[model samples]
Target: MLAFKVTTVGASSGFILTKEAMAKLNVKKGDTVFLTDAPGGGFRLTPYNPDFERQMALAEDVMRADRDILRALAK
Candidate 1:
C-alpha cells in the first residue's frame, strides 16, 4: 500500500500521489478519480465509474436509434 502525506494546496489540504500510484490508477494530470469510503473503515480509489459508464453506453444506443430526429433538431 502507498501512503501519502496530506499537504497544503492553497487553502485546502491534499495528498500528492506519486507517478507510480497514478500509473496504477490509470490516470494522468486532470483526470478524475473516485474516492469512496470502504465498508470496514478505509477508503477506495478508482478510475472507473460504472454507473456513469453504463449511462453513457445507454445514451449512445439511444443516440444511434434517434440519429435522424436528433439531426433535424440540431438545425
Candidate 2:
C-alpha cells in the first residue's frame, strides 16, 4: 500500500500526492478525484465518479427494456 502524510493547507489539513501516486492515478494538477467508501472499512481514492457508474447502469437497464423502441427509432 502507498503511504501519504497529512499536511496543513492554510487552515485545513490535506495530503499531497507523490509523483508516483499521481501517475498511477492518471491525474494531474487541477484534476478532480473522489474519495469513496470502501468495502469492509476505510476509503477508496478514484478518478472515476461512482454516481455516474450507477446512472449508466440505470440507463443500460432502460435501454435493454426498451430495445425494440430504440431499434425502431434508430431507423
Quote the lDDT for 21 in model 2: 98
Instruction: Report the C-alpha lDDT of model 1 over 1-75, residue by residue, as the tens digit.
Output: 888999999999999889999999999999988887778999889988867988999999999999999999999
* Alpha-carbon shift of residue 57 in model 1 (angstroms): 8.1
Best by TM-score: 2
Residue 20 shift from truth in candidate 2, angstroms: 0.5
Writing each residue's lDDT as its tens digit, candidate 2 over 19-39 gives: 999999999999999999999
* Model 1 misplacement above 4 A: 53-75
lDDT of 2 at 40: 92
- Going through the candidates in the order shown, the clash numbers are 0, 0
- Measured on C-alpha atoms, candidate 2 has an lDDT of 0.96
lDDT of each: 0.92, 0.96
- Cα-lDDT of candidate 1: 0.92
